[model samples]
Target: MKSITFLTAMTVAIAATGAEAKTRLLVNCFWPSSHFACSTVLPNWVEEVERVTEGRVTGIIPPKSVAPPPEQLAAIERGIADVAVMFNGFFGDAAVGPKVAMQPFVGSHDAEAMSKALWATNREYFADEIEQVHLLSQFVISPAELYSQTDTPINSLDDLAGRKMWVLPGPLAEITKKLGTGVVSGPAVQSNEIISRGVVDGHLGLDPQAVQAFQLMPYTKSTTKFSGAIYSTSFSVFANKDKWAEISPEDQEAIMSVSGEVLGAAFGRAWNEAAAMAEAAYADAGIEVVDVDPAFETALQEASAFVTEGWLKAAEAAGIDGQGALDFYKSQIGEMTN
Candidate 1:
């Protein structure tokens, strides 16, 4: 009888231990599985998470698996995904702190500097908005450049007037429209289709790697350097608030230690590498790359004022202090770049 009781107690304890040990986290990436962010950065992040957690946490990334880039945040909020990489521009209707980062002329062309600035901005002013979800990391992509099929170069601001251009909807689209270009809203992944079909005369947001990743270089006849980083997208790795709450405090600290500034720098380095690869690919493809004339760069800078004004108006409508946030973000970017 004593032996039987001891055996039963051991069995119950083993079952309880097994239950407690089981942990699964779902990580969603909007980019296709082949993209560097999904293929390289995510895997490295997963390894780091598991290593720090010591087998208490495990993550699974489904192939080509993601919600619409804009919907990633809602998916997490609804518990469809425990964690996801979200783009701030997608939250057009909300008070996302990073909107200031997307305003024209606010960020430098350097992804590393932009990423650091974004992280610092979050720490100083946007913490509450992001705290709703457990932010794992923050990063920014390189600025989008102009790619065109026309042999005539974009040497001046007037060159863009009345031209049909494929532009992603949101802040970037707003900037394109302000430039007097006919804007077509479409996913970045479909840029090849748009260019191949001649639905667009050119595209305004082709990052070097993105152009190469989607094979847009073949269709691209010319590339124009923008005055400054025309615009950049902000990305954040976040988990559901409840799910993050379940993590042990020690585990949370471990994760946070690896996130923010450190993770931002890692992503920036990856983007820099991707940019190098893209430049080589474009050269090999015989595509013409031109630096915008100084006069044109100045025109672009002047045009940027309209974009900034529009952002301020939009932010006011959303009940956020647009000017204050913009000022803070600018100061942070200056510090990081300097």
Candidate 2:
């Protein structure tokens, strides 16, 4: 009887210790819960974490974002959330490494390729810039195109400048303002407010999926596509440093087995599928898809030179070989495309 009682006590104690050792992570989503990144990407990663850790590590996302879009990284840094996604633009001049992915006419429309390349480049050159939080993965959406609600298609800079345009903040806004366009800049989620009220003549920084997701197709009469992406936004997924440290080293390696380039490619594939759906929706919505004129494309590329030059200089200041990274990124995209 004494032996049986001792064994039972040991069993109970071991079970309690196992429970105590399990880690539950709080993941926050800045976009609406229904947004693919929220509904799909983060949740998928959480599942992978649980699977790889054998249920020792798990995660849950709050119904809504813990903070505003621009504040996501700060929230993670402050430990308000264990993990979150952040736009590179929110980093401003503090980190120029991401700008290599944002340069005009340099990125591919393939989200997966660009995302993998971004991760590769980050690991090789920009790893030091991610000091505030534990970097997990990087991703970019499909390239953005200029869309017009007005009768006139935005085939030339004059047409764009003639109308007040709603553009995504960061490089696109700066480029438009430099080219003399009347610009209103904000997060993509807030685009509907101004657009639905006729506050702007057109929008300058949404891809097909974003247009469909934001319900902008009804107001869009035409969209102009460039030979190369006009611009693409970069995002970083990261965890709170303290929270990351709490995980066992074994579990950390297991979690990362599904992160980095693997996670990036997963995000890219999702975007590619979504954009394809949005393209079909564009046809059904009767949104005219206009090819950019070669001469105007050249002129616009020339005008956007300052954005890239500024990025190169800023990257150099950060001790990264900006040109080499940019060239490598482009080459990676090309190799993947071919």
Candidate 3:
């Protein structure tokens, strides 16, 4: 009887020990090593998860880790990594359906408003389009501005006409075409090479850190600020479906609690600070900054209608209620901006 009791006790102890082992997740980021989205915001997410789960869940980040930014969603779906951060524009080829968020001039310049709108849109309509993975949170960067290699300046819509411009393809590309500029499509990391080799006369999708990260400052001569931001990209955190299912319910809830607006606010603060840093760097390098005149701003606004119409068409082709989503997004943006 004593031997049997000891065996039972040992089995229980071993089982308890196994249950106490930490759950580990691998997070993949496509941003460069120095980008704040990778170095600052993602680390904060890992810390928050561990803190909330009381160390039952831990994350591992492999350095210089990334798949092609557009391929990140597919990677997560395939379990290439337990978690990944991906951009909406990267999936343009997949017919992943209309991501209205990528359409130029759709949202406010403030990340908070854009992030909230994205989150709400996902909850209301985008779940099926992104159903392959478990979504954690969605966000938008500040609107992209135009950067140029000449001090010639772009004050009106007509200024962009006949210029060779590098832009990410999709609605933005279509808009550029409508404006009569030749558009070159590719990733941000390749911008320096493209510009240096004269593949493009200028670039349209300039973010402060992105320009800095790719070392494009030496090639750029001017920065143009529009009346409103021209374009912005949407991003989200995703986990492999199987991996997400394996997490304990308690830990899952803990993670979800900190994901949406909370994560967006944190990311916005980080991005805003990084933008400031980039501005300082540009100033120190003697790069010229140009703000658009009110007359040109109105012309750019008229040109934006083409991009918005393109989004509506794409959304309809994908069978999504494009008008409904757009209206809701606008409403949310107004509320958040206020």
Candidate 4:
């Protein structure tokens, strides 16, 4: 009886220590818990990390984000959060490489292809540009399209220019201003405030999924379709460097097996499916889809030239062959679609 009691106590102590030894990563989500990224993508990623690491490594989303969207990268670097995702545009001049995926009309509507191409391109030309955190995956969202809340159809540049519009930050906002459009610009999360208060007559930079997620359906009266992505947002998933280093190298390899291109493709597929569902919902909401007028398309494309030029210049400043990288990314997309 004494021997059996000692053995049971030893077994229980060992199990408790094992549980305490497991590493739990804190994954932050800036979007609401119900948002697809939080409800689907991030949770799926955490599950994969646990599975691949054979339960040695695990992750959890805190009840709230450790920081706001713009400050996510810095927060992760400071070890306030172990893992997070950030928008490339929010990084601005500090990280120019990811913007290769953001240039207007360069990407297709297919999010998976663009996401994979971005991962490949970054590996080839821009890997060194990232610092402080360990990059896990890079992905791009579906393109933003023109949507009007007012009676205007946005059939011409004149129609677009005449209305006050909410544009996504970065290139789209710059492009809209150059075209003489009255632009109210901020992060996508803040879009509801401006649009709901009757601040803008139209919105120029939301994908179908975003339109659904941001609850902009009632305000959206019509959508203007472009031949390709009018513009796309780029995203990066990363982990705190010190926290990453704490994991065993073998476990790191296991975790990475499910990250990089694999994770990017997965995120893209989710966005694609969600975007499709949202578009289907548009008809039910009485939102009209307007075909782009050829002249308007041509003129908007022409006016947006400076935005791309500025990015290319910034890329060169970062010591990359901007045009070459762009061409490679575009060619990769073409190959995938073909």
> Which pairs of residues collide in candidate 1?
none
The alpha-carbon deviation from the true structure for residue 192 of candidate 3, after best TM-score superposition, in angstroms, is 0.3
Model 1 global lDDT (CA atoms, 0 to 1): 0.79
**Stretches of candidate 1 above 4 Å error?**
1-22, 313-321
Given candidate 2, what's the lDDT at residue 229? 90
**Per-residue C-alpha lDDT of model 3 across residues 1-338, encoded as one tens digit per residue:** 99999999999999897666667889997777667778888888999999998888888887876577768887788777889987766666443332667766676667667777878876776656766788788787877778777778766677787679988666667778888898887767777778888787678886787787678888788888765667887787878989888788988999988887778767766776667778899877767889878887777778778767767787887777888888887788888777
Clashes of 2: 0
Between candidates 2 and 3, the TM-score winner = 2
Residues 11-119 of candidate 1 have per-residue lDDT tens digits of 9999998679656789888888887788888778877888888867778887866688878988999888888987776655554677777777777777877887778
Give the runs in model 4 whose Cα sits over 4 Å from its true position.
Answer: 1-21
Q: Which of candidates 3 and 4 is the stronger one according to lDDT?
A: 4
After superposition, the stretches of candidate 3 with alpha carbons farther than 4 Å from their true spots are 1-21, 92-98, 317-319
Ranking according to TM-score, highest score first: 2, 4, 1, 3
Q: Cα lDDT of model 2 overall? A: 0.89
Please give the distance, in angstroms, between residue 127's alpha carbon in candidate 1 and its true position after superposition: 0.5
Minimal lDDT window, size 10, model 3: 89-98
Can you write out model 4's per-residue Cα lDDT over 1-338, one digit (the tens) per residue?
Answer: 99999999999999998887689999999988887889888899999999998899999998778898989998998889999999987777778988999998899999999999999999999987888789999999888989989866797888988889999888899888888999999888889999988899999888999998888998889999888788998999999998998888999999989999999998898999999999999999889998888898888888888888998999999898899899999999999988
